[model samples]
Target: MRAHPAVGDCLLALSLLFVDLLVLLSQARQHHGQPWYVALPLDVAMVAPVAFRRKYPQVTAYVILVLSVPHSALQLGIGSATASCVALYTMVVYVGRRQAALYVVAQLAVAVLQMWARWAPGITLIIIVLIFALCWVLGEFVGARQAYHAEVEARLHLLETERDQAGRIAVAEERGRIARELHDVVAHAVSVIVVQADGASYALRSDPAVAERAVRTISDTGRQALAELRRLLQVLRNEEVTREPRIPQPTAESLEDLAGRVRAAGVPVELSIEGEMTGLPAGVSLGVYRIVQESLTNTLKHAGPGARAQVRVRRAENLVDVEIVDDGAGKARALVPAPDLPGGNGLIGMRERAHLFGGILQAGPCPGGGWRVHATFPVRLDP
Candidate 1:
């Protein structure tokens, strides 16, 4: 229901002009001898500047104060006092207190000169002071309220920005976690299936039983990979929360079964544990298991014929250590560093897992003609 500022100001100026016209007509009817020519010009000049009071507050106010001097000397009717009060209020609200104080002083000086020149009553001065004081109070109250609203709006905007930033950061972290999980599941299973398929292709003519075993291994590996994939995809669903039980994530104790699987894929993995791994935190246990899993999977894919790996896990009082080493017999040349290659994130994914649990991982060609990966994570045993 609020109008534009300029339109409102124009309407206010016109209303004041109409009131001044009525006052002039009344004075003329009462035979005060105020001529229309002089009084009409004075009234027009007084109210005209008010239309632009908010746009050029200080200038409009000063112009009105200057004109009030002549209007008072000429003994014009109530229009002079009304215009001065409006300008004073405008200055206080739009300009500021310090400037408005100066305007009030100038206005008081004009009032005193007019009263003395006319020998007006003391009560007249008292009424004028009260009216101007009222205007000043209104300006102060409105100005303070506006400032409070502005401050509250600014704070709300800042809080909204922080909330949006936090949401984006959380989403990015979840995506990275999912990517690592997918890479571990898909890469390990596909490598095993490819190796078994190649072995089956050749053993079908020489040994039917070995071929059948390789085919069976391929079938099991595929099913396991599909189940892990489905579990990962479920996390991305947006359906209402349900109480469906989840498959438990593999931990450090599951490394024995992992080693047996790698041995079936033509890479013999010897796993050794030095200390108790019981009651380890879920995140730390998962990290240790993944680091070993990725290392042995790399050996299966790149380590040449006759390659064998050793996996050692040591759980200490405040930390867990994992080391995987394989004799480098992969391909004619040692496996080329694939860190920058597309679809080659085995090392990257392993390092990310370790760092997520406050750990460090190192992977490279060992000095004694093999590949070695070592990782250590800090953890506290649960009582």
Candidate 2:
């Protein structure tokens, strides 16, 4: 009823039984040796096993082969031929080629014995062999097609799994990049604001003019920080399509601007450049800028009061180099924590930026009582 194998096999068996019944009716008219009632039961037994050929191919084929003998002995027409052929095809497709080959040999042997005993014609034997051969060929072709489809389905599933893994990896990389950007931007801006705020509070009644400049520096730094934050948030919100003006990312050339800001925040900074810092690839240039910015922020935060920082940039034919050095002396100011500690996020970010671009960064205490940060990068990156 559901169009299943058993139902289909049962239908096929019924058709074979109908053909057998017609053959028996004709034999009875001729007054054959065995009565129609006697051969009918053998025909039913032989043909019924064909219905379970697919479920139990080996057993069904052997049962059909054995029952085919008595059915043929009674001169039952077409029932042995039709049922054996169907069983052989099922054996080839479901069981295996070698077992089917043996089964076919056995079927041929039985047919030969039956014909030899009856002294049948050579043409009938040839016809029986040809029919069984056709069934084997059809089984081979269909089995090959089913195997090919199964392989294709397996390959498609593997590709889909790999594609999903790649998408997840890309997402993780994007999140890491955003986290590094936020750390660099927020850390530098907050350091400058805190320094200016402290200076403003101290100079407020001692020197109103100095205090006024420091307060103005705090306001400017906060505004700049807020602007950069909005840009980051806009990117997160996927709003780049809007017509709002966008600030260009800072690059190697912005080191002078960065130094000037630190100078304005009550520390002296000397910036020096000996290379053509232009036309750098965007990622490399940005990495350079961030490394320097983080290093300078550490200087402002950790290098005590009278500490002066010097930044030097050099460009070789195929490389760019940056170095920041500062004396730890704060001129009797409160002692602050040292810079470039092993576990500091600022130091780690700088190193990760350098490593990302196939470069190296080293930061530690100078030989002559100061802190030094140095980084080097190649001009061209691997594709």
Candidate 3:
């Protein structure tokens, strides 16, 4: 098994202490009259304090300073001085700046005492000051680097958390788009159904043939609505109806049938196409069909019965313009703009569709009488 970090640190301190003890032993052997016993205890006392240098830096530094002052004054060996430098380095790195300043002052006081006792202001005092200053400066540099790395790690974590929140917000906005698309589909289908059913009811007794034709139109319109609904639901399902022929999405051509159904429901709707609609991209084409369909739906509701509506699609080299206009003179014209009261979902959906193609939409009361919806789309999207 690998040694724990704290265990490794403790062993490193003990190793430094053993090295200082060996140096003291050697110095005592070389210098006669020093005595091995006195050197052994003093050297052990000075170096052993380093074992708790980081854990209790201020206390350990004081202990090492106290042991070394007497040992250095007596000129017993170099071991005490070496251990003092190591303890001061540990103190400055771990005990904080204010305590380090105090430790430095205390060490300088000991040095002055030694100078006065020896009566010699020489190279020894200068060497001790230089060694202590070097250790404290090195410790401060190491501490600053560690603090910088810690700050960088904190900033990176904050950025990651913000990224996660942004992703969730994007997903929520997408779900809202899908919901709006579903609403447009259902609203358009139900409007056609209700109109057709009313006509069939009125003509049921007076004109059998006319009523039968209206019922057939109703059946066809229902089937088309079901197909559109199936396409919408496929987005949520894992199993797709691959066995059936893929349903064709609405395009410029599809507007012809849409107009016919609206005309049969007692609203006179005319669809006019200009330029090259076939060359437009699928997304832009769908955009054209949906905007016209929604506008016509709003017209039938607001324009009421016997109202005439016009849908125009004009394609240019790089732009396509669509407009739907009607006269607000029908029976239900007053009730048609109910959704436009405030925060209308229909108008909101149409505007969002125009914005999806980087297009502009203008919708409001027309100069003549009824409402008008006009949108412009870029024929070719930027690469």
Q: Give the per-residue lDDT digits (tens) of candidate 1, residues 26-132.
A: 88999894699998899889888988988999999989888878776766665567778888888888899999999888888878887898899989889988999
Q: Give the clashing residue pairs of candidate 1, or none.
A: 303-330, 304-329, 304-330
The TM-scores, one per candidate, come to 0.81, 0.78, 0.70
**How many backbone collisions does model 1 have?**
3
* True-structure RMSD, every candidate: 4.1, 4.8, 5.4
Q: Indicate the residue-level lDDT of 191 in model 2.
A: 93
Q: Each model's number of backbone clashes?
A: 3, 1, 0
Task: Give Cα distance to truth, residue 127, candidate 1, Å.
Answer: 6.3
Could you tell me which 10 consecutive residues in candidate 1 have the lowest summed lDDT? 333-342
- Regions more than 4 Å wrong, model 1: 1-22, 33-45, 48-52, 66-83, 105-109, 112-138, 240-248, 274-278, 330-344
Ranked candidates (lDDT, high to low)? 2, 1, 3
Error of 3 at 218 (Å): 4.4
- Select the stronger candidate by TM-score from 2 and 3: 2
- At residue 184, candidate 1 shows an lDDT of 89
The positional error of residue 86 in candidate 3, measured at the CA in angstroms, is 5.2
Q: Rate the local accuracy (lDDT) of all candidates.
A: 0.84, 0.84, 0.76
List of clashing residue pairs for candidate 2: 305-330
